[model samples]
Target: MSDAMTLREITDFAENLARKAGELVRREREDNTLRTDYKHQTELVTHADVMADEFITGAIRKRFPAHRILSEETMPDLSQAEELDTPLWIIDPIDGTVNYAYGHPQVAVSIAYAEKGQVQAGVVHAPFSDETYRATKGEGATLNDKPIQHSGATEPRQSLFATGFPYTKDKLEPLINRLNAMIHQCRDLRRIGSAALDICWVACGRLDI
Candidate 1:
C-alpha cells in the first residue's frame, strides 16, 4: 500500500480508538464508577483513566505491533522517545481528570500518532459534548467531521482566550502574571480545565487564543 494510504489508515484507527475511549470514560462517570486518586499529591487520576489507557494501547499494539506507545497511565517513559525509529502513539486517556472527577463536561480523550518526531494524525474526543476533533497531516482539521478554522482575530483586545493551569501550585507566580496580562489585553479569558479541549476550541474558532 502507498504511504499516504497507510497514513490515512492510521488516522482512522486513532479516531476510532479515541471514540471508544471517550465512551468508556463517559460511561464510567455516568455510572459513578470512578475511583479518584491524586497523582504526585496534585494531579487527579481515576480508574477510568487506566481502563481507557489499557483499551487504547492494547488495540494499537494488536493492530500495529511495530508502533511504540507513550501513554500517560501505563507507559510514560519518554527517555528514548527522541531516538526511536518507529511510529509512536501518544495518548492521554483522560485529559481533564479533575474535571472528569468533578462532573465537568470539558474532559477528553487525546490520541496522536507520530513518526520521526512529527505528528501524522491526532484526535481529541470530548464525550460529554459529543464532539470529535481530528486532523491528519496536510489534510486540515475538523470538528465532528466538519471543516474548522480559527477565528482569525488579529487584535488581542478583540479576541477571547482559553488557558489551563498546572495542578501543582509551587510556582504559580509566573502563570498568574501572564493571566493578568492576558486579562487586560484580551476581550475575556476562560480557564478551561482540559488542555486538549482548550486547543480544540481554539482550532474550531470557539476561542481565539
Candidate 2:
C-alpha cells in the first residue's frame, strides 16, 4: 500500500489480481445461464461483469485504499473526478460483456493504473487462454511473464486490424463513418468484441498494424 513500492512490486501485485479476475471470468465463460441485460440499446452487461467488477474493486481497495477507482459499470462523480489525479485504477472488469453473454471466449479483465495523467501500469488477462499481458510506463510489456513485442509489420496485406462493430443510432452517424473508413483500408478487419483483448494482441504481436 505504500507509495514507495517499486514498479516491479506493483506489476507483481497487479498480475496476481489480474489472474484472479481472469479465473472468475473463465468460470463464467463456461456457464450458459449468465443473466444479461442491456446497458443501452447497444451496450450490454451480464452477471459476470458485475462479479468481475466487484472482485477487481475489492482488490484495489485492499491494496491502495486511498487510490481512486474508475470502473465502467460504476463511475465516480465528475465533480470529484480530480480524485483520479493521485494513484488511480481504471478497471473494465469484463470488457466484452456482449461476447461473454453469447458464450464467446472474447472477454477479459483489464486494470490500468494512472498517476498524474500518465499510465503507470496496465494488466489485461484472458482467462479462456490464460494469456496475461502486463505493461509499465518504461519497463516494456510482457505476456505470461515473458517479454512481448508488437507485430512491427505495417503492410495492410500482411497485417490484421481489429475493431469494434459499428453501433446503430440516429445521433451517432459520425462513428459509423469513421469505422467504415478503417474497414476499407485494411485487407481484413476483425471485431474481437473485446477492447482489452484487441490491445493485448497488438502488444503480444499476435495482431498488427
Candidate 3:
C-alpha cells in the first residue's frame, strides 16, 4: 500500500462485501422467517444483521487483518495508534432493520473507511434497488460508477437534513425537535428509518433541500 491510497482497492473491497451482505439480506428476505430481536428500545437485531456483519467484516479481516473494524453490531478495540496504523472500517449491517423486518425493500448496507480519522471512502448499497453509491475523498463521487453530485441545501434552514430517533435518551428528544425544525424549514420532510440511505440520497440530491 502506497501513500496514495488507491481508490480501486477501497472501492472494490466495499462493493464486494456490500454485495455479499445484500445477498444475505435477499436470502433471508426470501425465506421470510429470519429470526430477529430488539437490540435497544425499539431498535432491532436479526440473524441477518449478524450474518451480514460477519460477512463484510470477515472479508475485511481476511484481506487486511491489520485494519480495525468498528461496526454497529460488533466492537473491536483499537485504542492505540499502531492498532489503527492502516485503516478503520465503519459498517452498519442491515441499516434499515425495521424495514427489513417487515419485508420492506428500503434496507441497505453501509461501509465507510476512515484513513487517519477522515472519511476517505464510503459505499452504500441498496440491493432492492440495485443502486450503489460510492465516494472517495478528492477523487469525486459516483452512483453505480457514474458521476454524482450533491444537491443538499447550502442553508440549514432550507435543507432537509435527515435524522433518526436516537436510541439513547440523551439525544432522543433533541433529535425529534431537530427533525420538527427541519420539516418546518424545508419544503417537506421524510423519515425512512435508515440513516445510511438518507445520507446517500442527500449526496445525490434526490430528496428536497
Candidate 4:
C-alpha cells in the first residue's frame, strides 16, 4: 500500500473489511454454538470474536503489510510497538460480544485507519440490520452510502442520549456521576452494548451522545 493512497481509497478498504467481518459475526450468531469466555471481570469474548479478528487481521496484513494493526482480540504490546508515525489499523471485530452471544442484534464490526495518531477513515457495519456507516477525513459521514448529519437538536430536554459503563469496577462512580448528570436532562437514556455502534448512532443522529 503506498502512502500516497487517497482517503477515499482507505475508507473504501475499511468499509469492505468491516462488512466481511460483520458477515462472519452474523453467520456465527446463527450457529448457536458460540464458545464464550470472560476476558476480565465482565468483558466477554466469544469464539466468533477471535474468528472475525483473525479474518480481519489476515486480510489487512496481506494487503497492507506495513500498516500496524491494533485489534481488540489481538493487540500488540504498546511497549514494543514503534512510534505513532506509522499508519495504524484499529479493529473491533465483535463490538458487542455479549449482545451477540445473547442473540441481540446491536452488535457490529468497526475498522478505522489512522496515520500519525489521527484517524483518517472509519467504517462500522451492523450485519444483522445490513447497515454500514462510513466516514473519511475531510468528508462527511454516511449511513448505507447516504450522507448523514447529526441531529440539530440543542435542548437537552428534547434529546435522546446513549451511554455505556466500562467493565472495570472502579470506574462505576465516575460513570454514574456522568449518567446522573445526563439522565434527567435528556428525554431518555439508552445503554446500548456496542461502543462502535453507539458512535455510529450518534453520527447518524439516532442518539445525542
RMSD of each: 1.9, 2.6, 2.8, 2.1
Regions more than 4 Å wrong, model 1 = 1-5, 76-82
Candidate 2 clashing pairs? none
For candidate 1, what is the TM-score?
0.94
- Kindly report the root-mean-square deviation of model 4 from the true structure over all alpha carbons: 2.1
Please give the lDDT score at residue 119 for candidate 4.
79
At residue 141, give the lDDT of candidate 4. Answer: 93
TM-scores, each model vs. reference:
0.94, 0.86, 0.86, 0.92
lDDT of 3: 0.79
> Model 4 misses residue 91 by how many Å?
0.5
lDDT of each: 0.88, 0.79, 0.79, 0.86
User: Model 4 over residues 1-209: C-alpha lDDT tens digits?
Assistant: 24678989989888888898888888877977788888865788998899999999999899888878899756765563446657888898888888999999999999988776677889999999999999998999999999998888799999998888777777698788878888888899998999998988988899876
Candidate 3 lDDT over residue span 15-54, tens digit each? 8889879988988889886998886656678899988998
Report RMSD for candidate 3. 2.8
The candidate that achieves the highest TM-score relative to the unseen native structure: 1
Write candidate 2's Cα lDDT for 23-107 as tens digits.
Answer: 8877766765577776766777777788888988887898888887889756866455444556777889888877777778887
Worst 10 residues of 3 by lDDT: 76-85
| lDDT, model 1 | 0.88
Which candidate should be chosen as best, given lDDT against the real structure?
Answer: 1
**Candidates 3 and 4 compared by TM-score, better number:** 4
- Rank list by lDDT: 1, 4, 3, 2
Q: How many residue pairs in model 3 have overlapping backbones?
A: 0
